[model samples]
Target: MSSPHIIVVPLPIAGHVNPLVQFSAKLVKNGMRVSFIVADYYYNRVMSAIAAEIQGEEDCHVGLQSQVKLHSIPDGLGPEDDKNDMPKLFLSTSASWPAMLEKIIQEINGSDREGKVTAMIADLHMGWALEVADKMGIKGSIFWPSSAAFLAVEFSIPNLIDQKVIDNDGVPIGRQTFQLSPSMIRMDTEHLPWNLNNDLVTRKKVFDFFFNIGRALKLTNWWLCNTSSELEPAALTLLPNLVPIGPLMTPYKKASRQHLSEEGLSCLNWLDQQPARSVIYVAFGSLTFVEYKQFQELALGLELTRKPYLWVVPSSVITSTKFSNIYPDGFNNSLRKIVGWAPQQMVLSHPTIACFVTHCGWNSIVEGLCNGVPLLCWPFVAEQFYAKTYVSDVWKIGLAFESCENGIVSGGEIKNKLEQLVSNEDMRERCSKLGEMTMKSIQGDGQSSNNISKFIQWLKE
Candidate 1:
């Protein structure tokens, strides 16, 4: 019989796309054929990522590449659409994507030689795909690429409404603390993912987008998350449908020396010469926009640490006219390296990385924790605050930064946090212990490994 075929989709962004692509690789490895689809706008980037990941797999597994097909559908966006504006991009795609995806699935199903698609696994952000999967009589699942704790909060929206913590529109009714269960950590109202946006209009639009995601989630036959039971015991227990079958990072990916760009290779080479546990790795994700003054403060702050640092500054900063001229007066290039991009999984796996100074994005949190690197959390917006809460408060593996009244994290504050993070033996030990447990979760007989086996069996059955 032909192997079961699965369709996979992801929101067109680095964090979202990377994991689902890796997950596609996993599906292919388990004797399933996969149709990996993306918006035309991100096709090239996604293809590049897939190629990089493939380069690291074993020779025996090389043939698996042929099993995972790549397909693209136009997002109905034009040249004039500002793809960088996430809310607008999501709102636009909501109108255009469902029909586009439906057409793609029809083509796949109609193919004479290809195996019929038995299921679809998509990023939760693209939840509407689940509805489409239902229409086609295929099993539908949504992958939560972030923390299960984050998923728990989103899944509990109805409960939040009943408790009057949030209104029907998903806006906070007051400054209140919420917990999916009493055993879980309480999160603040202001830090709720949708409430972080200062503009009410934008906030409502973002909330409504997620609200629609919640509606579509009802159609899911399986709700998979890129996390482990070891990391979020309470949240997983609370949401029984939330299966923890990840770190979704492939083992080949964890150990791969492959680079996405020349700049990334250069960053790894520089780390090679640094002392053990001495380099501070800093990367705010693709979506973070650092202001010019804050950028200056960060540069100065890394300098203040008097420790070697490697910072990944994304391409979005290229438009900042003053970005090039913001380094400290005595900034030594030998000790401070900035790259346009860095192969993050490789960088985190390096021996020289002492701690990560991060924006607390869920992907970053997972990578840092799995690598046993301590963190100095500097959250910019959205669910990052909740992620930081877990990092600093629940897991006790990291520390949070306090911004000044002006919202700039001063150089001194950064330096102090670095010192505190590095010097705390207890935190370092906790980080190491948690990292071991997390990495083990994906290995043989681990919780995540067992879950993945069960999921594959279900798909085949």
Candidate 2:
């Protein structure tokens, strides 16, 4: 039998693209031919990372090339010429998706490749892929790229609204606290992540998107998540045909440039001198921003914990000249060291790293779990709150801190949670066990591997 040919489409973002790249590599290992269709702007970075990873593999060759497939789509809003303007960028991308899909399908159909385009795998955020696949008569699967438990919460939003547990606007409509299904974690309007409350229109748009996703469930050939059933079995039951294939990472033994930032190596060397399980690794995923005051508080908290640590403080967070004063008294000189960028996977996989003080981004959560590092979850926005719920409540592998009255979490609270996660032996033991399970699920003969194979087979048929 000939190997199946698949085209994996990823949203043009670092967090989204990296996992799809890993998944594509896994498909190649399983004897499939793969092509990645990515935005022109991100083409070079994505291909470079993939090329670095596959440098020595003899039989497995992963092909990557750029196509101007989605340039015409308008994101219901005007064109966002500036890449740095995040709000306009996201809106423009979302609006442009429908037009982009039409162009991509045209390109694929006209290609000289022998086999017909058999299947389409898309990111949930790029919801237009379903429509494109339907028009092309190709099987379509939506990859949640998050925990099964988090996806379960998203799928349950309509039901929650129907029960008046959440308002039509996705705000908690009633005062009585109610838990969302599958994961069984409590939900409160005030506890939602930052995106839920920043603006009414934005919140509504997000809510409507999820609601549409829920309604389109059956049209989806399958749902794929970057999690294993062992980590979220209860949540898996909520969706009949869900595939969990991840903690997808660059191969542990391979020397890949995918994680090699300029400062990454230096950061790892610094971590080497810290005592085993004594360093807290702090990072927010790609899009989150930290205010100067909050950044200072976090620095102070780490200092108070008195643990050697590595922090990925983005340049934007330290732009203010007064940024140094944001930390606790004398913290800048008191701690071991701080760096602007860190080799995240290296730090998490290191023996000296005790816990992750994270913004609870899905990719970071999966990486932390794969390395068996416990987490102190402070979810800033987006699906982070859902990820936090899975880590703290469902998995019992981590803890969450209270957000302030204004829904902002302060450095003092961050300090308290970091101390608790590192000092508590029981939390450590549970995280270690969960981490082991997470690793096993992604290895040979594991449930995640098996399920991914099955999902591919279904796609072929």
Candidate 3:
């Protein structure tokens, strides 16, 4: 079969975009034509990036450079749009969806690209775009950005409601314990992804968002998760047509983290000074935010560890509140490494690192696992809590923090978990074994590689 032209829809968020961008390069490598639908805000930048990614290659034999195209979708953002608030940004995106759909349909019908527009690969957040493929009589698939467990839970929403574990609005039924599947972790109702615990209005909105996804996902022909089956066998097997084809990453992505080399040089030097596997590395992924008090507690907690550490507190934390003064005495004297935003993959791959104190974002977990580092799991929001369960309970590669009612993992708790994780030789050995297995799964002809090949074949068909 000849290579097919594929339309890819990506959520504008960084986590979603980063992996899909890498996947697009794979499709190009396999000699397929790709039209990546991008928000105008990032169009030129993405175009340049992807173009550079395939520059010397044949671009899947389409031409020297014509195989990949960037198509823009208005995100309802103008000079006046409020970019600070995400829900408002989401609402603005909802306003633009219909127009985006119409434009894409028109583009496909007009037929300017090569091999015909055969399929759409959309970020799961853009599940509604499946209708565009349906109207055009083409295949549609979802690129889920998080764990397969996250998708599995969304698939089981109906059962969760029927079991009286959660209401239609997704509020839990009076302190009940609910399992999305019998094999998965049993979770407290208040900690469910749709429940923010304290904010009813935002929680309801998130619930509604998932309610739409639960329906929208049924229309797609296939599910492509950014995880490997070896990592989450139960969740990967839970839903039909769910393909775990990832941790799809370039092995040398860390070598490219040179842009942050200067801010992180001192940290690297400090890591060199520590004994092997003796330092704790703390970084919450990009999107998470702890309240100022929690931030303070976390800072002090790291100090109490009395162990050398590298912590990447996003600069935004300091913007909202000055947390430095709140840190306990002797905090800076133990010596700081990576004050704000270190290159995560580099830090994880470092020999001096023992336990990763992480927010349990799927990317962070996978990276840590690939590097053979056990985690001190402190989940913040959404599927991160689910990831925490799979990490600590299911995968056994991590130790979870006991959080307070306010959802805060206090300083004392942090110190306790860090001590235990650093002291646990058995867990470190297990993490090393799992990391080796994860690497094998993504190598040539392994599960993820095979699934990706099958997905590409499906595109051609």
Indicate which candidate wins on TM-score. Answer: 1
Residue pairs with clashing backbones, model 1:
none
lDDT tens per residue, model 1, 246-306: 7876443444554366787788899999999999999998888888788878888888888
Expressed as tens digits, the lDDT of each residue in 246-356 for candidate 2 is 767764434544446567777777777778888888888666777765666667667777677787876655663454454556566544667776657667888888899
Residue 175's lDDT within candidate 3 is 88
Per-prediction CA RMSD (Å): 2.2, 4.0, 4.0
The superposed Cα distance between candidate 2 and the true structure at residue 208, in angstroms, equals 2.2
Over 4 Å off, model 1: 55-60, 78-80, 252-259, 321-324, 328-330
Superior by lDDT: candidate 1 or candidate 3: 1
lDDT of 1 at 424: 87
Q: Sort by TM-score, best first: what order?
A: 1, 3, 2
Error of 2 at 350 (Å): 1.5
Model 3 TM-score, 2 decimals: 0.84
lDDT for 139 in candidate 1 is 90
